[model samples]
Target: MKSIFFILIFTFSLNIFSQDQVLDITLKTLDGETTNLKEVTEKNSLVVVSLWATWCVPCKNELDAINDVYDDWKEETNVELIAVSVDDSRTVNRVKPLVNGKAWDYTILLDTNNDLKRALNTAIVPYTLILKDGEIVFRHTGYTPGSEDAIYEELKKHL
Candidate 1:
């Protein structure tokens, strides 16, 4: 009986992790247009959702590294990257200028209220979620110098 209970618990835990999905949340684009997270994922076979902030160095580095190879990734895997800025009202204005100055070719969205962040249970900036068929397939938080390669490798798996 004890062994059976443990097996059941383990299976339930695995199921919970495997079934993670993005919640439907409305966010604003840099162009002041409202967009739904579910809708964005629906349009793409694979979508890379990056939660970042203007003040995070690691987040900036991660995005910059991804930017350098974004086109290649897109061509290879048909993946679309959606950068969501979690900067509140004070720093929200900086998002557009920073994205423009860096010449990042990503679909930028503003999450001033962090509704999406809370829904995703993301604790910090530089959180990345790989969505396949509108469902969460992989998730990674924080960043390291060569982490972009790991992300590319994961994308390759879905291709």
Candidate 2:
């Protein structure tokens, strides 16, 4: 009977500890302001966090594709996209110029030291996450030509 009780207690503990959510990690904005990830998510019901780097072509393509239809997506679903640059200290300076050149309409944040990336256990660029109430609802790694459509479809479900 004691062994069974111990097993039940362990199972209960596992359930309680499994609710892991993103913590408030500080990141820099393009305007050189420090912001917290939790603060950003609280502003919107649903947020799309796109992790990308300046040198990644596929990441740029994914963002550009989303840019093309972002307005429409917002209009229909009220979803916000936060573009996170995982560019280390070496190429972090280029983020602003490239963003301006492309004229992306998403909130841009800089993860210079990849603090958020490591915290989230993301292993690659072009990683996208759908966050609801600061909890990660969906995640995708890598990008294809039509992946934006899939992203939009996922966003629609929460709307």
Candidate lDDT values, in order: 0.90, 0.90
Model 1 misplaced stretches (Cα beyond 4 Å): 1-19
Work out the TM-score per prediction: 0.87, 0.87
Q: After TM-score superposition, what is the CA distance of residue 133 in candidate 2 from its true location, in Å?
A: 2.0
Residue pairs with backbone atoms closer than 3 Å in model 2 (clashes)? none
Query: 106-141 in candidate 2: lDDT tens per residue?
Result: 999999999988776666889898987778788888
Q: What is the lDDT of residue 20 in candidate 2?
A: 45
lDDT of 1 by residue, 54-108 (tens): 9999999999999999999999999999999999999999999999999999999
lDDT of 2: 0.90
> Distance (Å) between predicted and true CA of 105, model 1?
0.4
